[model samples]
Target: MNNLPEDCIAKILSLTTPRDVCRLSAVSRIFSSAADSDDVWNHFLPSEFPAGFAAPEGLPTRKRLFFSLVDNPLLLLHDPPHLVSF
Candidate 1:
């Protein structure tokens, strides 16, 4: 548990959902760090998620960008016939 490297823990956490990762963060210091790692969040983000598009001017982390998108999704109206939220 605590002995596991942060990268290893992040790899394992990547297989789980965002909600699950957040819950596991409190289990240990390593878990908390792993949960906040970009590797874990990358798995949670969509495969087609645009690069650098979601990030704000301040250059937020992948996790913050993920939650930001989740809480306030971007509306894509480029195609009038098919409006979508990214």
Candidate 2:
């Protein structure tokens, strides 16, 4: 299982819940990296979640944002799904 491609693992994990992803992260280093990826969390986030949420463009930051939104969903409701400019 550890030998599987990171992105492939992420894709499989994406089909599972956040709890499952976190649990699997403890299985190995590869799992840890893939479990924390943006691709996996994007599946759990609201369908409208903007990819640009990674404004700081860091791996950890993107994971943190995912958890923040999960822990406090109101933020999703508070902002427009996408920002607009004139």
Candidate 3:
């Protein structure tokens, strides 16, 4: 696994559950780095996410963005102040 390219490792990680990924990250330095890659985390993000929506300020990576949305979903407002849930 250490000999695998980072992108390849990330792709393999992408197929696993987020919980699996989190656990894998603790296995080794290489696994931890691959788990943190945007390539892996982006696969966890919803496909229907807003095209132009900006992530909250200071969120660093795709992994952080995924966790943020999971913990605190972003809310949008439509006309008439209707709440739009992501």
Candidate 4:
């Protein structure tokens, strides 16, 4: 790892899948920020579901539902209706 250049490391990390990135982030400080960068996030969002894969109606599960909601203003409205106090 010491021999790896920073750019090459970034590129390699960038190509890593999100789950791996999340796991790596816990390994060190530098890795945590690198994994959370806009470059990584931007790459992640679009790659999560391939082009033309539409969100299923009503989203059958919470993970799917959250992904669809994260970038949507309309779904923000749904949160108020489903709020559960801890």
| CA lDDT scores, all candidates in order | 0.80, 0.75, 0.81, 0.54
Ranking by TM-score: 3, 1, 2, 4
* Tens-digit lDDT string for candidate 3 (9-84): 8899999999999999998898999999987877888766554455568787888988987887766554533325
Evaluated against the true structure, the overall lDDT of model 1 is 0.80
Instruction: Provide the TM-score for each candidate, comma-separated.
Output: 0.78, 0.73, 0.78, 0.45
lDDT of 1 by residue, 6-55 (tens): 89999999999999999999998889999999889988777666544546
How do the residues 12-54 of candidate 2 rate in per-residue lDDT, one tens digit apiece? 9999998999999999999999988888987887776666664
By TM-score, is 2 or 3 better? 3
Evaluate residue 29 in candidate 4 and report its C-alpha lDDT on the 0 to 100 scale: 69
Residues 1-86 of candidate 4 have per-residue lDDT tens digits of 63565455556777887678778778766776566565555555533333333446886433344455565523212333332222
Regions more than 4 Å wrong, model 1: 51-54, 75-86
Clashing pairs for predicted structure model 4, backbone only: none
Which candidate number would show the highest TM-score if scored against the true structure? 3
Q: Give RMSD to native, each candidate.
A: 4.0, 4.8, 3.7, 10.9
What ranges in model 4 sit over 4 Å off? 2-8, 47-86
